[model samples]
Target: MFIDRLDAGTKLAQALKDHPLVQKIALADRLVLSIPRGGVVIGKKISIQLNSRHDVILVKKLGAPFQSELAIGAIAETGQPFIDQSLVNQIRVDDSYLREEINRVRAKIAMYKTKFRQDKELNLAAHLTILVDDGMATGETMKAAIAWLQGQEKTHSKTYHLSPTTYLIVVPVAASNAATDIRALGVELVCLEESSDLTAIGQFYERFDQVTDEEVIKLLAKN
Candidate 1:
């Protein structure tokens, strides 16, 4: 039982089963868009259980100055990722600095897109999009992913005549306030653990290994 609990993949699957949003969206029809790296493992398990389309959404965070683990912004599949402007301004990050970081992220996105996003444009119109991540501390990455999805809805409306889009955010653990902020975006949010006492995401899990780009690519290749 201890080895069973220590398995991140198994724990992730069980957590998703208990998640309210997962119960609602992991039905017969839906697509799961998991955040790259850690989320890929969770997404794979969910895909097996739900028998639905599963794909990865590459979202990279722009680290805060002097505190690299602290994210001030994040880049999703789209061109411009979401940035907590107020936080950036409060931290005294000038526009030039932000631009430099954003451009760097865009380059990374381009590389990922070439490697992974070569499929037909995701027709999220009238489809359920479930966004997943391994964990959440600040929620900057999830926020950016949501904003990017919204942008896709708008841009695709002009070219492809499709209906509105629906999205959901699913994570294993998240800060209470960060979960609240994500819920305010008017989309369904699922978190197995929401603790106000939380400080770091890795603290909640026993094995929090760093996932590399090559590993992520290999995982997604199975989809």
Candidate 2:
């Protein structure tokens, strides 16, 4: 198990150094857009190691009603919301409720972007954009993030006429099933460990304390 997010980030950054694409890409051409507030900790270390720009990509989980800890799916700041139809059906989530949740989450994402990010613009023009997170459970939020990047690429092509960014997902640990689903999205994934019996992300970390908004802001400021 990792000593903490910093330990995981160091290992992940080391693994990234061996990737063929990362080896070829210049540090200036790489951008680390991590999901906050945990991901910012990981991303900061990566950015420092690689001498790359660091930023946050906002996405929020759509929690199941009553069981708020259980994620139904997720919605990115931009792009279509990703919902697990099977899970929704199992939990009997209705369309109206889903709509309301999406709207609510989007608003929260907006507030976070403003609060945590201020007026910093998203750097979508990087040659390689690495998505870092503490871990992947259902992988819904990461998928939503990938979709958002694709949408940005489409919009960018019309104006700047540039090649699409090479998207990569990096995590300290993940469930085997979630890793497979992430790979199916066609982006490169670098995970330290993939376990079939993974219970929670915190399980793999020796000290998985909650990352605060202030910590996230400080990390981003360093980059």
Candidate 3:
């Protein structure tokens, strides 16, 4: 009932505000990161209200060949990314196909970096990182993001001389199963609504228009 009954982003924000886990962590004092296209609007609002650093954590999904809407895997902000191994195995995607998709996603990330390099100077060392997306269905993108964060911690530990920071994943709405799966990753999760009513993320949103890359770039510039 919480799903499809209110403004997706606002409701999600409020839910996070009320959650005991969120209260314990005090997200208002942390660095809030979000993936573009979906996370930009939500992240901006949260940043303004909470007085936290809102930055984009670029993640692009690798769509199925010919059926581009079907996500097979996802790439995170860092160069490291992941795919649903079971899905990849079930689909019988060859190494060439996987490489091609990976390269495509990397190219997209490169373009994003080129456009927003100036905005990447925020100090993530010892700062709490909150990752946001609009919603979740398969949890592939969230998994990729978590994996990427681990890699970043490993690679930057020496240079930054900081221990791995805590991460929290927030979303407006998510499949009950998907939320559970994400929580099992041993990270804090803040999901506002969990329902079987979810078919697609857009279905619950009253204003589910596409967020362009240009808009994301502009948002980053402002922050």
Candidate 4:
């Protein structure tokens, strides 16, 4: 268990220090892309420890109709959406609902990019790209970021040379199922703990509090 997000970030940053990829990639070539607002705390620690660039990766969960807490999937800032077909099929979700949710979630992502990043674009030309989150339960948001990065690699391979040697996901804890799904994406993962019967990410931290947009803005500014 962690005392708070700061403690989790410290531990995760230490773990990254011993990672094989960290040994191969130079500090200047490492880019830490954190998912706000809690993940920004983690990302700050990582960037400081690794002496790398830090930035926010905007992605929002697509909540199910009448169930805002339940995520059907997620959409990233690049407008790439990852829908959980199995969940949608089980819930009998229709295409129209998904289309609407996509538009709404994508709009929120754009707003975050403007507010948190001031409409600044990310530099994807790094040797190692690290994605950090406080913890992962369903892992949809992180997957959305990965999907968008993969798309960039394909689309800008020759034009911009945007392919990184490695893409790593770091989190203090992750649900076992979500870990498996994330590994299937072919990215390296550094998880301090994997819970088979995971409930909520807050359960692992004693001082888990909601992070505000203002706090996120400050953290990004520090980077």
Ten contiguous residues minimizing lDDT sum, candidate 4: 156-165
Clashing pairs in 2: none
Comparing 2 with 4 on TM-score, the higher-scoring candidate is 4
Report how far residue 142 has shifted in candidate 1, in Å. 0.6
* Runs of candidate 3 exceeding 4 Å displacement: 1-7, 18-29, 119-122, 158-165
In model 3, how large is the Cα lDDT of residue 5?
A: 24
Provide the lDDT at 211 for model 1.
Answer: 74
lDDT of 2 by residue, 1-223 (tens): 9999999999999998888878899887888888988998999999888889888999878989887767889988763688888899999999999899989988888788887778556766678889999999888888888877788788777542224338789999999998999998778899989999987889999999999988988887787
Overlapping backbone residue pairs in candidate 4 total 0
117-201: candidate 3 lDDT, tens digit per residue: 5535435553567788888887788878777777777877764322333677888878887888888888878776688757788
Please tell me which model should have the higher TM-score, number 2 or number 3. Answer: 2
Backbone clashes for every candidate come to 0, 0, 0, 0
lDDT of each: 0.73, 0.85, 0.72, 0.87
lDDT of 4 at 41: 92
Error of 3 at 128 (Å): 2.1
Measured against the true structure, the TM-scores of the candidates, in listed sequence, are 0.84, 0.93, 0.84, 0.94
Candidate 1 lDDT, 12-105, residue by residue in tens: 5676666554566636457777787788877777676666678777788988878878889998776676888889988998888788888998
lDDT of 4 by residue, 1-223 (tens): 9999999989988888888988888887888999988999989988998899999888888888888767789998787888988999999889999999999988888899899888888777787899999999898888888888888888777643345348889999999999999998778889999999988999999999999999998888887
Return whichever of 1 and 4 wins on lDDT: 4
Where model 2 places Cα greater than 4 Å from the true spot, the runs are 158-165
Question: What order do candidates take by lDDT, descending?
Answer: 4, 2, 1, 3
Candidate 1 ranges with C-alpha deviation above 4 Å: 1-12, 15-28, 118-126, 158-165
